[model samples]
Target: MTTETPTPLVDFTAAAAEARAIADAAGVVITAVDEVTAARRVNQLAERVWGPGVGTAVDLVTALAHAGGVALLAAQGTAGEPATDVGFALGFLGWSDGLHLHSHQVGVAPEHRSRGVGLALKLAQRAVCLEHGVRLMRWTFDPLLAPNAHFNLARLGASGTAFLPDFYGQMADSINAGDRSDRLEISWRLDRALPSKRPAAPQANESLVLEADSRGWPHPTGEPLGPGCAVEIPGNYSELRQLADPRAPAWRQAVGETLAGAFAAGLTVAEFRNSRYLLAAPHRP
Candidate 1:
């Protein structure tokens, strides 16, 4: 017998009008939803894309399907079967050519996970963005989740752009009820520079520490940092991971706004030191 690669069954950028129709064509059905309610579908966008709930935590999208708000990628399992919905969308912070953000949902139905659906969907999104000339795609995820780390950094091809400890603060949801949600901000710098492939393996006992290499970390939310008594910050510092707190909205809001600000200022992450995954900044001084 011979085997051939499968093609993406649906186009996320092309399915803004009929979400359910897309699902029906994909052999996956959102049972309770029949008539299209923008509000409800928007909420689905928020929930399903919560990849961390499945150990691949991602952030909340723009909450709508405006021209650039969000989208759905659907597919059918078999002939005469309902289309299975498996993709999500993203948006730009403002009018910028190479800077934008996105959120997506990638998992097989309980019966289908461990299958290739997740990877298939991700590549589809990559196709949509690359086809449209999107230069960057960014999102947030919990770093504690190893599968996600391996997938984003290794599979789908993204890197840690920033780290937001306790990004979501706390949630009473079923998935994150008892754990502190520390997150890593990721970016797919779509260009000739970044490549999408897994590393051969974890480095062998290599010592790495991400030096401060700056005055101080940017905490634009200014949410109280006790006090600072020294000037001329050291080039190297050792700091432990951030405390996980549900009350920590500063991590996300501030980081999101400021990272967007840094990109506006022409700054990009230079590298990542593996020891603690310290996010390295461009040495533009």
Candidate 2:
């Protein structure tokens, strides 16, 4: 007879508790949206973030919520005052190899950014997924934005699995109106422990596949050199876009080609640090 170790149980209650603590510290209240009124509020908040005619319709949000999807709203208010909506996250159930949640969008009011409300909403979403036996979540985001790359890869401990150029084609939103919609598809394992701190910055000796020029534009330096390589991007891509800088499209093309090639060569984005994406080769067992 042989003794075997039992697998540890997923502590979903603890996850929910921590999410609640984060929301409390951020001074925001997160609630599930199940009714038409709440769904409409979510749509309104989306419009405020992305611009008019860019948000999902109220009927779709309502339908998704009623069909066992995850739709959450974040608000802030005092004891007697009515709560003002500040953020929303929407996702639907998906299945590939196994059940998972495909997070479609997460938006925060411009005035409410940098307050940890976004992170709180994500954690709350994670808790909801784990409770429903969904251990995996997937989403896509602009790969050239340093802050978004750091938020998803470093803050959430998610892994970028693919580089998709022009993933959504042209868009009319204020944020991405004139640019290609290149995206990094990432997967988050909800059962895994969240990162306690950001990853260490890339070392000075690391080879850079992409580097910024003196004019603050991206340029491809060389092919990825397996593990311990880095890809530097603009720290203020939004500013470049706002100025209609010609270099903005150059940055987009350079980053898309570099990441797409790197992924093709079997390298993965291990971490994002120092406004760079650090690459590593997958482990073989």
Candidate 3:
């Protein structure tokens, strides 16, 4: 795959301020984790987000922090009260054509969902990367999860670059036990402005490559490759998994194959809206 031109240097001061403001608005305090105790807290938070028997070791988290990588913890509390860790983000330096940060894992506590905690953690991560002279950050996430897709592509203004099928093989975690570990790799340019707040509704002529039925079962439309198309995923994938619905696996396979094919056909994920990924033709030189 080809790489885009590097973004110009961002205003580190402004970025850090924005991160702090976001954390404050979310009623959390964001801080770097360099001590063993903080690293353990990160690991515990990860286990709670994923499941037992699955999380980065405390030693590794500390090593990454000491090595100049990002290891941040977000907690909620006030003065005179003990702060409780509610979210954490971990990443390390990477080389992809040039230097960048590969965000490994980021999670928020269950009770903190929909409270802007995840966005705050990500903006803080972006600020740390900019401070370290890195303008790009990449991460992989399950494409079937609409909330995550919106967070990465829409909220953070990242774009999906590649579709990786079964990227992690079989995961033993509670959230992904029987599901395929297919992922969409996304790239975030920290120097760029956040995406506009306008809605990303599909255009009139955009074809539907994959869509969900009324009952939420995924179906491939077999639409021909075109300059614009959209792929719809389930809005409540976790509920499907919880109920052991047979259509859950089907949605995974169908959406994965459809998106993989779209990427292979020179289509790029332009935006995600209404639980759908809108793909556009690659830009010409």
What lDDT tens digits, residue by residue, belong to model 2 across residues 1-285? Answer: 999554344468978998999999999999999899999999999999999988879999999999979999999999999999999999998887568899999999999998899999999999999998889899999988988988899898888877888999999998888789999988887877777684475497788888998878777786646788888888888888898898888888888888888899998787888888888886331
Q: RMSD to the native, candidate 3?
A: 3.5
Query: What digit string (tens of lDDT, one per residue) describes model 1 on residues 1-285?
Result: 999453233334442223333344444433222223533443454455443333222223323344444344333356776545543333434333345646533444344444444554444445445556664677777554445555666555566666565667875554455455556667765432223343454445422221122343423333221111111112122121223432233323434454344444444433332312322344321
- Give the local distance difference test score of model 1: 0.42
- The alpha-carbon deviation from the true structure for residue 267 of candidate 1, after best TM-score superposition, in angstroms, is 13
Task: Tell me how far the alpha carbon of residue 103 in candidate 3 is from the true structure, in angstroms, after superposition.
Answer: 0.4
Worst 10 residues of 3 by lDDT: 4-13
Of 1 and 2, the candidate ranking higher by lDDT: 2
| Local distance difference test values of all predictions, in order | 0.42, 0.88, 0.88
All candidates' TM-scores?
A: 0.51, 0.93, 0.93
Residue 7 in candidate 1, Cα distance off native in Å: 24
Residues 1-285 of candidate 3 have per-residue lDDT tens digits of 999775444577888888889899999999999799999999999999998878789999999998978999999998999998899999998898568899999999898988989999999999998887788899999998999999999998888888999999999988888888999998888977777678776578778988887877887887886667889899988898899899888988888888888889888887899888989876432
